[model samples]
Target: MNSVVRETPARRELPLPDGAISYLEWGAGEPGKAPLHFAHANGFNGFTYRRILSGLSDQFHVRAWDARGHGETTLTADPARHRNWYVYRDDLIAMAEDFKQATGKKIILAGHSMGGTASVMAAAARPDLVRGIALFDPVMIPTAARIVMLMSQLLRRRGNPLADGAEKRRAVFADRQTMVDRYEGRGAFRTWPRGFLEDYVEGGTKPREDGQIELSCAPAWEAANFRAQGHNITTAARNLHVPFALVRAERGSTCRPPFPMLLKRRDPAAHVMQVPGSTHFLPMEFPDVVAKEMRGFAARLEREGR
Candidate 1:
């Protein structure tokens, strides 16, 4: 039986320009406990990982934020002006800095997919604020592919399949159950464990003035995130000076070949592992595994006095 106390995280918001960055926090502030900030994947909210974060609450101060254009974050998300994922990196850096100033302690940065990639970038840029990093199948495209995508962006070409799909995704639903009924066991959500899907629906949607619930992340902005993949994550990974751990999915992983290999080569101390029979949604499918890895990583960092 799982003995970890699963506390319902408290919802909070960090003020930012034009809007606030909404977040969910767990664990009481205990002396000597290192803070861990978890970022969510694109189109997902912080509440989506409540089980994992809540489980870690006993060991570390756990907090997860809804990125701009996702969840209840009121940040300006003009897809037309968005260029790359750097905005996410910058936002995360700001949050880390704010947390550090408030608590007077360095933080552990962790995330899934886009959130993971952004955490890497932020850690590389400001390692002083981050004690360590934990990533789950972050989207690290090959250098060649990044170059090709850069060229496409430079040419102003649009219409990525992922982006197109996001744009066409159903945005409005009568209620949470209706949304859950539509996404319970289909497509990318097929591997999601029970209650995770319901949490996603709860956090990923908002009540509109029309008495209907709609996706908190606008379809256009989600599509924009899919298209804006020009950031240099390889360089960011290579520049890590702090301890880090990476969990890769066995199937449909965005952290493709050569990236993880090269990351290990650059930082032999970096902990990288691939879970068998796991998909990109590994955290959702195997929350216990993800939580265990995170707790172990954070424990190591604490033992090292980081």
Candidate 2:
């Protein structure tokens, strides 16, 4: 059993193969109704969905797990697990098994970025454990995404990519209001709340003896993970015998090849929708929209007896 007690509405923990896995579990409703299992993206943790989870907790059980390197999970002492991509997937697999054993039901796999890719991989490997899948801007097009991943990896041995300045790379604010303000000002941080960065920083860092915080998941590990992004989603997605849906942000990068459009166009079974006025971080950028779409998708699957 998971030796975890809820610290906040957004964070939870579970004992996995290696150690305790920190996660963000949401939604209330009744028990045994097929919960939505969420997964976070890179440079962010599960609590990034704080506001989003609060609104959806009433209708469905929304659960998000911190990947091997983020949130309360760590890899500083024994870097072996975070060093490999398969370790993250293996941790997720354990989470699925734990949830299934506890609830006696499969879940609706929902993921973002790398988490989205991991969701696909998990569903592909354990179809019986997944009734449906919903992915948000998962790093697709194994080639390009892999390049990005490799670039991140290359930066690991060299130095922190964002070392030049924290103000440049990704986030715009250290505080919530500051983030919201800069979102419109800088144009990159829009739609995301302050909690996203807070949770990300909290989950991604560990205390150092010299009072410095070191990244829990090494940049190299993250790079290696990204480099392996091009593992062929088409083949994996095609073999998906379950219902699947995709929610893409209007301004985000593509996770798959452009041909997926025509391919999905021909395969009418796969449903895809665009979340307008949103960025790559659908859950963070637009939680209400994400919840509304996810609820509808899950409701349809439930009706179909999935």
Worst 10 residues of 2 by lDDT: 163-172
Candidate 1 CA-lDDT value: 0.88
List lDDT for all candidates, in order: 0.88, 0.64
How do the residues 1-306 of candidate 2 rate in per-residue lDDT, one tens digit apiece?
111223346466787545788776654436755677888876566766655655666666767776875667743323333333455556777888877776778878888887887787778778888878887887666546445655765677443333223323343234443433444424434454555545555555566666555655555445445444436566566565667778887885556566347336534676688777767866767666676777788888878777
lDDT of candidate 1 over 18-131, digit per residue (tens): 899999988747766678999999899998988778878877887799999999899999999988899999999989998898679898999999999999899999999998
Inter-residue clash pairs, candidate 1? none
- Indicate which candidate wins on TM-score: 1
Give the poorly placed runs of model 1, Cα more than 4 Å off: 1-5, 152-158
Give the Cα-based TM-score of candidate 1 against the true structure.
0.95
Q: Give the TM-score of candidate 2.
A: 0.75
Error of 1 at 55 (Å): 1.0
Off by over 4 Å in 2: 1-11, 27-29, 75-84, 142-191, 202-220, 258-267
